[model samples]
Target: MANKIILTGGGSAGHVTVNIALLPELTKRGWNMVYIGSEDGIERELMTPYTNVPYYAIKTGKLRRYFDWKNFKDPFKVITGAYQAYDIIRKEKPQVVFSKGGFVSVPVVIGAWLNRTPIIIHESDVTPGLANRIAIPFATKVCTTFEETSAHVPSQKVEYIGAVIREELLQGSAIKGRNTLFFTRSKPTLLVMGGSLGSKRLNEVIRDSLPLLLQEFHIIHICGKGQVDETLTHQAYRQFEYVTDELPDFLATADLIISRAGSNAIFEFLTLQKPMILIPLPTSSSRGDQIVNAASFQKNGYAEVIPDEQVTKDRLVQTVHQVYEQRSIYMGNMQKVKKRDPLLAIIQLIEKTALSDRSRNKKEK
Candidate 1:
């Protein structure tokens, strides 16, 4: 019988992308896989077309960070979702569960714990989310994208693996050093990204600051779907709503990047070893995690953080010029850092854990 493995997580690309990078390797190793995600989240939409692996979606709603009277029902919803997840796990009897935490994954984590299943969870930010924080005690192993994340959780439960960004990024990092996407002059290329939807604030700042950058550098802007039609008619900006296949090509070619400090994007920038100017979303971010992630990246010397309230055309221009002027120094700083081979590490972890579980079952038989 083939070894079966169950993977669960979603709500955003930050959580779901971890699974995207790992799934292909699991399939290559001949493991039967099933993906568990929230019915209404982005995961089911993103993963369904790519694989035949069965997907089970449970009804889930996001829990607000701030206290509201409506918060009273959260535990009840979690309990219901947990029972649903428990039923799914019992039917599949997979060897192990790998969860990337979000509110949607809470029930699944609880179910895995209740069922005596071995569980591994990945935390992508310097600060762990409430779901991951709660699930840490039940996890067989906890992997973190930042060293700081462990400070908030028990040290013994964490492994600092760096963020597991998508495999396409690793492919983007292979060669071309600082010149892949839009190389005009020997001057650095600047790649702009604002989450999956693009950032109106960052776009506005960049739009205002474009003339100054255009004189010295090439710009590849992922305006995201929302701003694709926005009037960014600047001669210097090469904008796209989405470049699904060419994103890696753009990153590989960039010398510098202007982007939001999303966990997945920041890790990709570091892995590529490029200098970046980060504009983190407001403290009121939907997930309330981007602020911490931006601050953490600044502390680590990987990037410069520009808070949303402080981001302006002049500041954006000045910071871009400052980083460019000191390119050699910043690039050297990035080179001093070590990066994980996300694909190899994730693939090994899943294959080894699944095989081990299979071996134990065989012994029992």
Candidate 2:
């Protein structure tokens, strides 16, 4: 019989990318998989086409951290999500639930708990988010991408697993050959990304500074497709509005990267052993989680953090220059951080949990 499994969480690529990184391993191991996500999320578009697995979407929204009148409605949504999840759990009866923390996962986690399903939650950031923090109490096994997360979690149940980066990142090709569009002067190339929907603020900063940056180094910017138009094409930038599958080629070519401090992107760079410049979204961000994440990586020397106030043209140029001049320092510090083949670890965890569930079932029978 198939060992049933369900995966949840999707507000950003940080939450969705974990499943992408692990799907190959799950498929190779022949485990049956189901996905639980929000109806309006990118997961429905990304995961459904790739896997022939059961996927269910729940109605969900984030509860504001600050006082807002709309905050009153969140409790009702939580109740509605729980009911939706209850139906999914009853129909699928998954043996184990793996969640990447997000608002959408709250309902699934609660429903799984009520059904007595084994729960595993993975926090991909240096700190746990609100959903994962709440879910930690009930999670049978809690996994984290960063060691520092244990402090805020207040749970002895947590396990520190290196970030589960997409498998391709771990096996990146060695830096070699002449400078390409993404690299110039064989001086490390820095990749700047703002996530799938893209960051207008980051894009504007890059636009302001790119004219100077291009003279000294090569850059490959993943300007979100939504931002692409005749106006940007006229800019003197070697950029990609869209390149889905060849993303590995771009990363393999980069020597350094400038990116937002999304846990998924940061870990991807870590896995590739590339130096990073992280700009957490400013204080006014909707979630305010990226600022905390960026600071944690900076504290540990995994990357350097540049506050939005200091993201001027001069600062951007100076920061890139400083890191390039001291390339060895950044690369050396990154070594202290861990990198591994997460495919094996995920497979082992799933198989172990699945077998344990089957054994318990036999005993009950």
Model 1 superposed RMSD (Cα): 3.0
- TM-score of each model, paired residue for residue: 0.88, 0.90
TM-score of 1: 0.88
Residue 319 of model 1 has an lDDT of: 91
Task: Please write out the lDDT profile of model 2 over residues 227-293, one tens digit for every residue.
Answer: 7534554222556665556677678877778888888888778767778888888777646667888
> lDDT by residue for model 1 over 1-365, one digit each (tens)?
78787888887777788888887777887878888888788788778776668999886656778888768976787788899999999999988899988887888988988887778888888777888878888987788787777787777667677777676676864245334443455566788888877878787788778888888877888887768646565545688876666778778777788888889888788877888888888877656578888777787677888889998888888998887777677677778887556567666676677777778778989
Measured on C-alpha atoms, candidate 1 has an lDDT of: 0.79
Poorly placed runs, candidate 1 (over 4 Å)? 67-75, 173-188, 286-288, 355-365
Global lDDT of model 2 = 0.77
RMSD of each: 3.0, 2.8
- Candidates in order have lDDT scores of 0.79, 0.77
Q: Relative to the unseen true structure, what is the Cα RMSD of model 2?
A: 2.8
